[model samples]
Target chain A: MSDAPREIDALIEMMARLPGLGPRSARRAVLYLIQKRSVLMAPLAQAMADVARTVRECANCGNIGTSDLCAICSSEKRATGEICVVEDVADLWAMERAGAFRGRYHVLGGTLSALDAVGPEELRIPRLIVRIAEENVTEVILALNATVDGQTTAHYIAEALEGTGVRITSLAQGVPIGGELDYLDDGTIGAALKARKSF
Target chain B: MSDAPREIDALIEMMARLPGLGPRSARRAVLYLIQKRSVLMAPLAQAMADVARTVRECANCGNIGTSDLCAICSSEKRATGEICVVEDVADLWAMERAGAFRGRYHVLGGTLSALDAVGPEELRIPRLIVRIAEENVTEVILALNATVDGQTTAHYIAEALEGTGVRITSLAQGVPIGGELDYLDDGTIGAALKARKSF
Candidate 1:
């Protein structure tokens, strides 16, 4: 016996389908939206409609944008002769937030998985190879996750790009900034020790 | 340097303003929505628009519905000569989920608060009194939260209805049905002990 109107109940169900939201939280969010309908919910609905109409994946790099090419891929200033390959758009966004990588990104969409039957062709791997040649890319930075599947995909990409004259590298593993030694995982501690650099 | 398109970024920003979502989770949710655009995002947007267009507050009970009178307020079977007064629509929804009470509900919008300057006029107290007389209501159940403001509002309502001849009662205080004694807070423990019942 739901107290909310039918439309509101439907809205809550749909919201629960979104990432990071459960049925309980979705109900709470819907109630909050109804309470602030004029201020927040209306604007959010308009924004969602606008984004649904205009948003698209960048044709060249698989990044999301309103244009054929994403802002980073289209920008002249970001056309560094290097490409950073990431597992998904979230990782690309994380890298962008860091503000350290000036080179454009290639979102693989997802890592390879034998169990899931995902292969290089299923992702943007072939497109990435073509971009490396077309853009005169000097380096291919494999910024995949540290998961087993991510590492496997990285190794596969590295092998595929062999003899292409493109320098391939990956993100260095070490102790993270602001990380406490006591809270560090055994694997991270071991990696930090093995990759010890001269201070 | 955001990797997403301008419209997509704006969508993420708006989603971040939702009650439970932060900037990071908003970005993730946006990316997920974009990925499932045809199936999930489009439907969600349409639902939001439909709700925004059709949904309105029930004039009689302040419950959000598609019409002037909400389903409960308009139902003849629900006119059981009792009214459950709640602080917000969420509380009303919670009560409905319980399926315990058969009578209608009156949403007060919020509790009385001297610090925030909320008064009886701001809530539905006057309307509640009017309903008691018009409907010949026998019982007025106060199902407000246990916060100081909620209790203050309850007491104020009880005093206002002193001469109205309608029976006024509040929800009981005790250990919750599934609550663990060890995990119970000091205040809850004290209340449970004071309200201890015979087997």
Candidate 2:
């Protein structure tokens, strides 16, 4: 019978809307918070609230931050001529973790998708173009996902910048160093075969 | 070689401290956010900040809220004679999804843990006793976890409230409906056997 309080229902509804949380999972998460009121729940709520209040989008590179302009953009050292372009923030963070690339980043937001009706106008493509000329960027790494949409967007960008003379490169494709041939699907096998190296 | 910016390291350290997140996962997650700044990272950061500013602890029940008290504790209609006492908010939320109980709740925060030096005073036990007297409650259901510490804490509370005259009960232990025997663990089977009925 109708057991949950009205307020609980509201909380559950909002939680269910989360990316990975369904109604059942949302209920469990809420209950866990109630039980760990002092330790887990209270702290989580506080953190959530704090982030909600102070977080904003960086105007230049589209990174998230407390200020209008993100720390990377404001930093004079990161204003190198090379700008690495990526499809998502996660990829940008990955490059940072690797500690390899010295230049800054330009997040593309997402790959262009004909199925989803997503276009260059919908992404940060225009802003990226402006940054290319204004920032005097020399090399642009097309660090997009391996998906078809990602490749399509990459090709489109490379074609558009034909006269700009900026060197464009992409992450190599082939058998992943750690990948087991047994685990790969047929399409992956075909891709790896086509991109095989002389070594 | 010192590759990443100093601010990046600081951010990674904080991320590693999140529950279910290790350094490896944190690295991956950070990378993801950076790449998808406009579509994902920016929005996620904004949401986090917004929640942080608005979130506060409930004065009465200790639930998370944007105001003084959470919606459940503020509603007078929820002051039913029954109160389900659970070890965590997650359990409370689970019960809510089941839609089985119609009364308010008492979140115990956590079970008594001698190893961690956690005691009744550290939990919401005192608050619960006060609620029983002030709210004129008739029933107090123990909905704690099945762990050893959880049961010990339950017995302690039951003894403490000897003269309180509140009816106490627990969820029945047995073979969960539609659960396969092969999938059932030893403890579940033992509980089901002990609580077996004359069928």
Candidate 3:
């Protein structure tokens, strides 16, 4: 019996589920839509609906697009032989923003976690292997997050693919470039010291 | 010549125009959708499209809805004879989160801005006055931001409806409980003193 619309409530609920947006922010966003119905809300809604209908995962690389294959996978110009593996879409987005890699990506969806009972099957491990053989991929870059589960998953994948004649690597981990030594915990300092080589 | 789609580029451009989002974030968001087409992107797009088609401004209170009037404006239970006037819907939502008032709202869309040449006509000032008579409004609470423009707008409204005898009030400006008095800026301390009553 509240004054708000059912649709608005649904939208708010979905928005609340998003990272960083809580019930309060969701309500604020919904109210803003109410006021800017013509210029902002309507257009945003339309875009959302359109994307929901047309978007699909790339059959080859798990990338999203309006077709069977994503834009990156479909593009011949991309360095297809080099696959950058990431834990989630968010990480993939971060990589893209950096504009450092000119290759396609493989989204594992998540990492191996014994606590959560997640395994390689839960991830796209088998599919990733199949894609390597199918696409003639040579280099597999592990761009997963620097978390315990993420490292465990990467190690498992590396072990599984040994003797496949494919080169495997990972994103270098240490103290972030702009981080202050005083701010870092003892664990990070030890890891950085241990990992340090010629550099 | 780029691998990205023209539609996607256009979409990114539109997203860049959103508040709190820049070109970089927009690009990242679009790329994310492309990578998670089935799970996230597709659903988001469809929702947007559906909303765009069905959404419209409520003719009565300017809230977004699928019909001529918003659910809040049309509800019988919400006929409390009190209208909370706000500079924008963001403020309205904030008020709703507080859940103190059970009244309907009037979104002015923006504060009266002289520097930007915004006037009563630019905002929904006339519509608000008209609604007061039609809705039998008893109290008109001014919930504008504590800015010079906001105060100017409130004063103008007060003068305009001098004979109507609507109880005009504002949010109390004072030290928030648990906030240290020493930490307060000069303006806040002055306002607190000015607004201090028979305490």
Candidate number with greatest lDDT = 1
Question: In model 1 chain A, where is the ten-residue run with the lowest total lDDT?
Answer: A1-10
| Native contacts present in each candidate (fraction) | 0.75, 0.08, 0.23
Report the CAPRI category for model 3: acceptable
DockQ, per-model, please?
Answer: 0.71, 0.14, 0.26
Candidate with best TM-score: 1
The Cα RMSD across the true interface for model 3 is: 4.6
**Candidate 2 docking: what grade?**
incorrect
lDDT for A6 (candidate 2):
45
- Sort order, lDDT high to low: 1, 3, 2
* Per-residue lDDT of candidate 1, residues A26-95 (tens digit): 9888888777788878888888888888888889998888889888898999966999999998999899
Q: lDDT per residue, candidate 2, B1-199, as tens digits?
A: 1123444445455545544456766555554444444565445444444444555666555555668866677777675688788886566666776877777787777789999999988777888888889888999888888889889999988887789898888778778899999999999999999888896
Displacement of residue A39 (Cα, Å) in model 1 is 1.6
* DockQ for candidate 3, C-alpha atoms: 0.26
Which candidate's DockQ is highest?
1
Q: Evaluate all candidate structures by whole-model CA lDDT and list the values in order.
A: 0.89, 0.70, 0.75
Better candidate number, 1 or 3, judged by DockQ:
1
Per-residue CA lDDT of model 3 for B33-77, tens digit only, reads 555657766565555555656777678776667899876787787
The sequence of per-residue lDDT tens digits that candidate 3 reaches over residues A1-199 is: 1234566666666545444456766566556554566787667656655665676667777655689988888888898889999987657767887889998899888899889888888788899999889989999999988778888888999998898899999998679889999999887888899899993
Candidate 1 whole-model C-alpha lDDT, 0 to 1: 0.89
lDDT of 2 by residue, A7-118 (tens): 4455555545444456776566555444444565445444444444555667888766668886777878775788888886667767776877778788787889888888
